[model samples]
Target: MTASREIRLAARPVGEPAPQHFELVETTVPEPEEGQIVVRNTWMSVDPYMRERMDDVESYLPPFQLGAPMDGSAVGEVVASRSAGVPVGATVVHFLGWREYAVMDAAAATVVDTALAPAEAYLGALGTTGLTAYAALTEVAPVRQGDVVLVSAAAGAVGSIAGQLARKLGATRVIGSAGGPLKARKLVEEFGYDAAIDYRAGSLAAQLAEAAPDGVDVYVDHVGGDHLVAAIDALRHGGRIALVGAISTYNATSPVPGPSNLFSLAAKDANLRGMLINSYFHLFPEWIGKAAGWLADGSLHTELTVAEGIAQAPAAFLDMMRGGNVGKMLVRL
Candidate 1:
């Protein structure tokens, strides 16, 4: 029998998860039951939202049980399949956490074509990241022609795609805010943003004013706190704010504070809408179609920062939370 290595939550992390919070253990691979497949994980995603799972709080999704393998999106190759529908050599995407191998029901995994993109891309760009951007732009924060769109975490997986989607949707200006100057430059030069602001620089309000002279019509917020506050201050009348994530406050041990300038929303007559991607899973196919079209036509770009091995997954995750990643963060096992 083959042995597989897996990472499990050893304890609830108080702040950022350290090596002690996770324990790596090896176990014998289990036999695949009927209608199930045994997959060998090739890539795993490490996202900011995973930080929230470490806490024992009531969330849209259940928190990770102590001593259980931490769950997230992953792409793997089916090594053995007992079901007729799932072929042995097919690459698939599933919510199978962090493990070298896993045995799951065929129905729980979706077959993905490796020919379309790299296997890791299934866990990133072509997968949830792209879908999230498409949904948030088209459904959550709809933008019209000549609209000014501002995106936070601008060089990140969802933010980068969201800015591009806004531009494709006919936004006159696509402005983005990233943590560093390099990332800000990449946002303008590589991702096709009309203008990009470095939030790490001078006053956020001043930077935003220079980037978006008229006013922001739609704000795709990924990094909350000051970024959200700045976006609110720069919004035009009737602007829409898509609350995608709050990476800035994800690692805070204390109670995280909301945007201090929230009253600006009422003054601007803006709408702030919270978005949970899982709640809109039923509409994924539609969003995927539009995103695929943009990707195929060269209107959308997918970026990634891949860590070499699963051993580095935790560091990669911590790095992402600390603003060390340029795009989707993943571990290539």
Candidate 2:
């Protein structure tokens, strides 16, 4: 038997997740069955959406089962394969993560061309994270030429790309909101944002108004609550807002309140739309075609905050939740 290590949910967290909520256990990966492949995971992703999944709620994704291995996006090289379609040396991206090895049906894994980008990139910039940014601006909100755009959590995986992509999509001005002064500075200096607002500095509504005095034509909301309310108030007439994520309210033990100024959307004839990347998976090819070229030409830039080994995955996830990461938070196994 091939010895492997996997992380299981030891307990559900009532509030913010702690290390006790996870358990690293040694296990075994069995031989692949017909139409299956065994992969040694090289990289895995830790995202904000995962916090919601840890709860026992009926959300977009199923809650993590106690005593069961937690799973998410991962990139790995196939070590053994019973399916001819996926060769033994193929590099694939799949949903089984939080472990050193994964055994799953070949159909569940998509063969990724490492020549176009690194395998680990598929978990961040070239994978769902990047796709979320592209789909948010192009389909969900569709940034118009000369439009003023605002992205919350601008230093994050999706926001970092979204800001740069907004400029490429013809936005005349781009504003970003981050938790700290350092991240706020990076938003303007590195991520191509014309202005940056440090939410930690207080008075979010005032800061947003100062950044986009004319009004925000399009907004990508990653942090819900106050950020959503602020965006609603500063929205231009007939503006568009894409509800991509709500990292702010993910760990609440009680029901979180809605944005107080949500009625402004109706007054301004604005559109507030919620988006899920899974719904736009069909556009992956179109995004990669453009994004890959942008990366090669240095038009698009991405950063990674990496944690080494499977044992560090839980701590990495907790740190990511607390905004300890600059970009995509990854665990290198």
Q: Name the candidate that leads on TM-score.
A: 2
Residue-wise lDDT of candidate 2 within 1-333, one digit each (tens)?
Answer: 999999999999999999999999999999999999999999999989888888898988999999999999999999999999999999999999999999999999999999998898898879999999999999999999999999999999999999999999999999999999999989988899999999999899899888888899999999999899989989999999999999999889899989878887898999999998889999999999999898888888889999999999999999999999998999999
Q: For every model shown, what is its TM-score relative to the native structure?
A: 0.96, 0.99
Candidate 1: regions farther than 4 A off? none
**Model 2: CA > 4 A from native:** none
Model 1 lDDT on a 0 to 1 scale: 0.86
Q: Across residues 128-247, which tens digit of lDDT does each residue of candidate 1 receive?
A: 888888778888888988899999998998887887888878998999989788998999998889888887788988989888878899999898898888888888999999999998
Error of 1 at 251 (Å): 1.7
Model 1: lDDT of residue 282: 76
Instruction: Give the top-scoring candidate (lDDT).
Output: 2
Clashing pairs in 1: none
